[model samples]
Target: MYLTSKVVIEKEKIKKPRGLQNTLHDDYVKCKEECRKIEEREITEKYIQYLKTELEAAELVVAQESAALQATSIVSSNNQNENKLDQVPSEDSILKSEKETFVQEENLIV
Candidate 1:
């Protein structure tokens, strides 16, 4: 009904139907442009986008969006923390990795 064709009473009246059809047709056509411009308020792109955003915020995965935002902030904060520290791997971590690698090599050679 939204994008459907407008009333074509004028065109129908061309054939000149009688009785109720004729009377209703004349009645409808009498209005100022016959309600063709009934919906005068233009639907703006901004309003439509706002409506869509509101609908998504209300009905869609709001929690998922919040979780994603929190995860992103946490990741960014972690990166910032790492940058602030500006340090290489600690001795224990490096030693642990080296030991793991050596164990793997020994297993391969055996």
Candidate 2:
């Protein structure tokens, strides 16, 4: 009878620690899962913020390029107009040349 009681007490002691270990393991797993979820959320938010920044930068570059193209176009158009004006002669020069040629022809005939 004494040996049987001692064995029973030992079994109870062993069972108690096993139960406590199972509970601790379950709690550890829950904590790890929560940490993983938080990390994933943080990483996703950072990526979203990065993408927004990149989009804004791209838009700015595009706007700058568009403005440069427009300025170049205006400058080129002005230069072309200036060139055309440079090639054209004034009206007074044509009349002076014609009068000189007519007088020369009259002197030749005389």
Candidate 3:
């Protein structure tokens, strides 16, 4: 009877350590899962920041191109106006030609 009680006491001690080890394993898994969640959140935030920077750069490029296009259009319009001005005769030259035509007509009538 004495030897049997000693064996049972040893078995109880072994079982206690096994239960503690199982609880420790569970805690370790939980910590690893939390760490993974934090890492994923950080990566998502970095991606969002990268996208925002790209968008701002695209907007700036678009604005610069629009301004350049407007400047080109204005320059083209001004050049067209200058070309039209060059083709038209001055007022003084027009009056001189008209007076010459009138004198010729009077001579022909005489």
TM-scores for all candidates: the values are 0.27, 0.62, 0.63
Which ten-residue region of model 3 has the weakest summed lDDT?
12-21
The reply for model 3, stretches above 4 Å from the true place, is 1-21, 88-110
Winning candidate number (lDDT): 3
- What C-alpha lDDT does candidate 3 achieve relative to the native structure? 0.93
Backbone clash numbers for all candidates listed = 0, 0, 0
In candidate 2, what are the lDDT values of residues 1-110, reduced to their tens digit?
Answer: 99999999998777555537788787988899999999999999999999999999999999999999999999999999999889856678789989899999999999
The digit string of per-residue lDDT tens for model 1 on 22-72 reads: 676767776755455554433465678889999988766878888899999
Clashing pairs in 3: none
Q: Write the per-residue lDDT of candidate 3 for residues 1-110, one digit (tens) a residue.
A: 99999999988777555537788787988899999999999999999999999999999999999999999999999999999988878899899999999999999999
Name model 2 segments beyond 4 Å from true.
Answer: 1-21, 88-110
